[model samples]
Target: MGVERYNDLFITEKQKIFISDFNNNVKYFPDNVHFTLAGEISSDPGNLGSGGGWHRDSPYTNQFKTIIYLTDVGENNGPFQYIRGSHKKSGYKLINKVLKEYDYGENRFSDDEILSIVNNIDGFKISTITGKAGDLILVNTRGLHRGAPLTEGTRKAVTTYSFRNKIPNKFYKT
Candidate 1:
């Protein structure tokens, strides 16, 4: 078992086109991109998935991501899961009140906590991304998401994170 990360990856022209259209803006650039191994996880609440528990990236800032699956992923291989429309609800007044004034912007939550929030939020649902090798998943990472705990086999994937503005190298190192 091993873990590794590459700061920024240079992609092909076609890949660039896909990302540009995915963001709906050509001004974005890759801030971080890397492949990692997602192994099985214990049933501990605090130690969940590759991205940890449900959370957003870059805090209040906007970000986009493309995850390319290098292997087959089924129900138990720690597929990436996301809460639909959670990004738009970040500032919804009623949902904020229902959360007891807790802001989830850049916050991580357990399944139970997220479920409670999802139950109350209208039109919110969890989407688990599963696919065969070479499949790619595009996501607005400002929304809530995480890798479901791995049960068997291995999940290998590369995540390319892009942003409208370049972030400092210092932030990427840590």
Candidate 2:
């Protein structure tokens, strides 16, 4: 089922256009990619599911992700939220330090910890993205972001993860 969805996304014209546009603007190719379909309908508001807590996809590497909403997302539903401009080196360092200190073994930051970190960062802005089906969001997952908890209704989406090794290889151009 997952593979089928991924293949569908790969062949879709809309997705192709998105990827092409993204590739044109970014330095690295969106290679080593994988996708997942999240159909979350959590009744517990506090439960930070796999992608629900404030966390980075990788601690020390650069990675990107594209999230396409399959269902209409509202504030009450699980909207994709991000701390704007948090992908910079300083922001990354700050977040990494906080996560290391509060490392709970799960690689996810608690709400209090996330809030505290946000408070410490000057001019930090949290953006809640609510969109209709087919809306696409490109994000650097090395920043502070999360899937906001759902108060009601289901939130379905497909997220593609693309990662590249930071170390330069002598044989291949990164």
Candidate 3:
């Protein structure tokens, strides 16, 4: 879906509250927003049908995202998964080092790479977010996250992307 449809779906008071919370928590104004409908019946379980693999939304920048579930999400229905606390400096540095070694482009990480990064992090936890319609999750997209494979039903969700605007530094003569 597009921005208009996303705005329409996000009109309710609860949605407003959630969005407000996201803005406050992330301390940034959202510049871009979008929606997506997934998990239609398909014979082939390709990238489109199965959704994306494990990866960060923005690898270099600190971006914040809020996902609002429009339908019930279960473990078999392509739930959202995240590596907890992976947004911290240490976590990002560790992952960045591994990514550099692999020379991977700005794309999803392979299963082997995911495993290696997770193994390097101390006390890393994987959290699978399964919730009902209207459930909202705010995340630092710099961390490792992905949409799990859908084995049964579909998932409808809207995501808001917020980034910190860069201001040029002005130099002055002494």
Candidate 4:
């Protein structure tokens, strides 16, 4: 829907106001950039059987995402864990290398390995973003990120992404 509708879904007024500004900044994204969709992430329908663990967004250039909480978050409930500014240096290629090396033959990197990669990086800073209903996290899509496990009350949040215009994928992979 619209930002105004999303404003009401948030738990606080200040958050609503801040999101409004966020929307503006998104609208002004340079023509060279393409804005991605913004929406909610809840353990209700879409997340019914999924446990989004620590992982970064699809490795792509000129892409970014913003996450807004509509519910309280804590250690019990899955909260977002991220590596601050990781987007500034590493990208999809580098991240894959780190994962491949750390995961061995697992194909997927474990949480510890992910954190280690971020921490060991030259300018890396890892953080777990926990906040009340109104907190928001803006992430560089190229940055590493993932949802924490939900152990308590349902977790509700909205996410939006922006990206540079590029040709759509024409091939399908099985």
Which regions of candidate 2 deviate over 4 angstroms?
1-12, 23-25, 30-46, 96-106, 165-174
Question: In model 2, how large is the Cα lDDT of residue 101?
Answer: 55
Q: Rate the local accuracy (lDDT) of all candidates.
A: 0.65, 0.67, 0.66, 0.55
Q: Highest lDDT: give the candidate number.
A: 2
TM-score (all chains, Cα) for each model: 0.73, 0.75, 0.74, 0.60
* Candidate 1 weakest ten by summed lDDT: 1-10
The pairs that clash in candidate 3 are: none
RMSD of 4: 6.2
Q: In candidate 1, what are the lDDT values of residues 6-113, reduced to their tens digit? A: 332334466556755666553454334333332344335434666877887755655677776767877877799987777665534544665786764536666777
Name the top TM-score candidate: 2
Give a tens-digit lDDT track for model 2, residues 9-40: 43368775785577445676544544344454
Which candidate do you rate higher for TM-score, 1 or 4? 1
Clash number by candidate, in order? 0, 0, 0, 4
Candidate 3, 60-135: lDDT as tens digits: 6667767777788888777889898776767766777866765423547887888877777677767899999888
- TM-score of the candidate numbered 3? 0.74
Alpha carbon RMSD to native, model 3: 7.5
lDDT of candidate 1 at residue 55, scale 0 to 100? 80
